[model samples]
Target: MLLAALFLLSACKTEPANQGFCGIIPKRLEAAMSYGTSLYLGSMPDQEFLREDQGRSLRQIPPLEVREDPMAVQAVTRGRCAFSIFEESFASEQKELQGLKSAQLLYGYPDSVVFRMYVNPAALRGEEARTRTLDFLDTLWSDEFQSKLEFYGLKPVPEGLRTQVRNDLPGFLTTASESE
Candidate 1:
């Protein structure tokens, strides 16, 4: 009886191990540029935003453009944006952006900001893993996570500034990366 109880206890205590890639966002101009671009292109009223808006409600306005630029990515949500870090010409502009501490100020707008990073999703057991990864991203965008980001140096972008930057995403990403 004692041995059976011990075995059951140990089995119940077993937990899954963390197995995934460990990525790093290099503190450089490229990262900053990518972040900025994402902020510009990913904000609400952007293409993706319009699509979601249309899907949810019939009165949404169509976006001016349907296709994203080949060189950029965006978030198009209230929480975050997607920016690319691997542009080829980003190495040359490092000198021009020396004093820009945060990507938020690079655009000369106080309310909007860009985010950059290297994310390693946990080792997924199957197709469901992808879904899990997206769920994890949702948590990152939660208000609780945003507060933590502010503590680290990133600032939350306001809705109005987000609209203004949506048109200049590619250039912003390229410039920021080069400056890095």
Candidate 2:
């Protein structure tokens, strides 16, 4: 009986989902000119946004090729594409990696890529696990982590967005937990 109870307690112990969650990392992409004569989009989100805005705010621009961000940078570095959309942080990092010297920022866009905290579905299975997961999610926004965002080529979530996410997180957490 003692051994069975110990086994049950051990099996019930919930560990924090440190590796199962993703931290929020806000990043924006910039349209950069390199060597090609035509424009291109590196990320799917940018392509989708441009497509949606084609008839409205971006009527003057034509449809462009869509490629992975790294491939877009490579194409520009290799002089295959004239311009490409690159995340601000990735642009700087890739320039150094590709030994690119002539890439120029053509236009700045609003924050379009913001990663949100996502806890593993398995972590929301029980009350203790849910609490631990929620606590872990909150720590992602701590000052220490926020301070390191720039170093990782990410921007801190703005206060407004932070508040919005904070307001919405509990509902999401509760829903996820209840669903389990």
> Cα RMSD for candidate 2?
22.7
User: Model 2: what TM-score?
Assistant: 0.34
The candidate 2 region of ten consecutive residues with least summed lDDT is: 2-11
Instruction: Judge candidate 2 against the unseen true structure and give its global Cα lDDT, from 0 to 1.
Output: 0.34
lDDT of each: 0.28, 0.34
Model 1, span 1-180: residue lDDT tens: 111100111111122111111111223332332333233334323456544544532212211111123312221111121111211223123332232222221221233334433222212223343343333333333344343344445564453443344333323323233546
Model 1, C-alpha of 170: deviation from truth (Å)? 24
User: Best candidate per lDDT, number?
Assistant: 2
> What TM-score, computed on C-alpha atoms, does each candidate reach?
0.27, 0.34
Q: Residue 21 lDDT in model 1? A: 10
Error of 2 at 152 (Å): 1.5
Candidate 1, residue 127: lDDT? 34
Measured over all alpha carbons after superposition, the RMSD of each candidate to the real structure, in angstroms, is 18.4, 22.7
